[model samples]
Target: MKFTRKAQAKWKGSGKEGTGHLSTASNVLKETPYSFHTRFEDKQGTNPEELIGAAYAGCFAMQLSFLLNEDGFTANSLNVNADVTFEDGSITQIVLDLEGDVPNIDCEKFQQIARKAKEVCPISKLLNTNIQLKISLNN
Candidate 1:
């Protein structure tokens, strides 16, 4: 199975004064706005790190769901939050906070599955930074 995703960016001006527009292959981003202030000053626009965090969170949650089904547990619901740490112009770390409700599963077992998923997730394996996971499971 092979697939490709794409996004493009265009910038005008320079540095913190410049503004950019981002668009994806599917137009989901449709000329989204971004700027130095958005990334560094927490302004009202999307940033690269925030986008990466969103992708990671979504991928990890889906991986967890696959693992839960493989273990014969019916996942009632799953939620994951990714915290991407950007420092000194570099990505320092990523933390995945997951909460799930699954039937016929113990906390210990759920943790084991979560840890395994974290290691196996494509995005997690692709990122080399310090990665951590916090999981809460409910029966």
Candidate 2:
């Protein structure tokens, strides 16, 4: 919303047999390789689903951190893992698992805030598929 980020991807040859490269403005992924084998065969390379998972996890964590700060709580650490489900040439669902170390926060409250963060995260809002959140709180 506030920042304009950019990423470029180029593919050559056929869909299943071809290869592609992806690059981001930050250069974190500079011409990274992706192909059918990498995406669907569990080969060693980067893929779109994994990249989306990373972005969603990071966005949700930051949003949750901000929400905690607003409630006068500070998080020592927040670990989030996003699982993207791709089936039948479509992404059906995404699951975000969060484990947080925040001092003096109840599980119920943390769960509530985490759910809210999932609703409001930029990536979550941008996505059109089903999204679910699972939370584990440590005080």
Candidate 3:
């Protein structure tokens, strides 16, 4: 099976002074405001890095769940936090911190599955930078 998703961004004015709005096909982010202040400063708005982080976190959690279920295990909760590091005009690294509560699973098995998921998740494969995973499993 194959699928594609679409999102659009419109920017106006100069790089530092300009503002932009992002919209997705799903309408979840319709005309969402983003600007230099939002990306570089502490202003209240959305940015590319945060969006990437959110996507990675969501993707990894779902991938992990699927892998766990394949092994006859189910997760009670899987909390993932992705921190995307942008430096020197490039995305340097992404760190995924996962706190999972699964039943009838050992730490070693959980760690192995999580590592595999991190490697195979779509977003993880799309990124061409260093990726790190930190897992805290409660079984």
Among all candidates shown, the one with the greatest lDDT: 3
Better of 1 and 2 by lDDT: 2
TM-score of each: 0.95, 0.97, 0.98
What lDDT tens digits, residue by residue, belong to model 2 across residues 64-117?
999999999999999999999999999999999999999999999999999899
lDDT score, residue 121, model 3?
Answer: 98
Candidate 1 vs candidate 2: the TM-score winner is 2
Q: How does candidate 2 score on lDDT?
A: 0.95
lDDT of each: 0.91, 0.95, 0.96
Better of 1 and 3 by TM-score: 3
Residue-wise lDDT of candidate 1 within 65-116, one digit each (tens)? 8988898987898888888999998999998899999988999999999999
Query: Candidates sorted by lDDT, descending order?
Result: 3, 2, 1
Off by over 4 Å in 1: none
Position 119, candidate 3: lDDT: 88
lDDT of 1 at 114: 92
Predicted candidate 3 versus true structure: per-residue lDDT over 1-139, tens digit per residue:
9998999999999999999999999999999999999999969899999999999999999999999999999999999999899999999999999999998998999999999999899999999999999999977
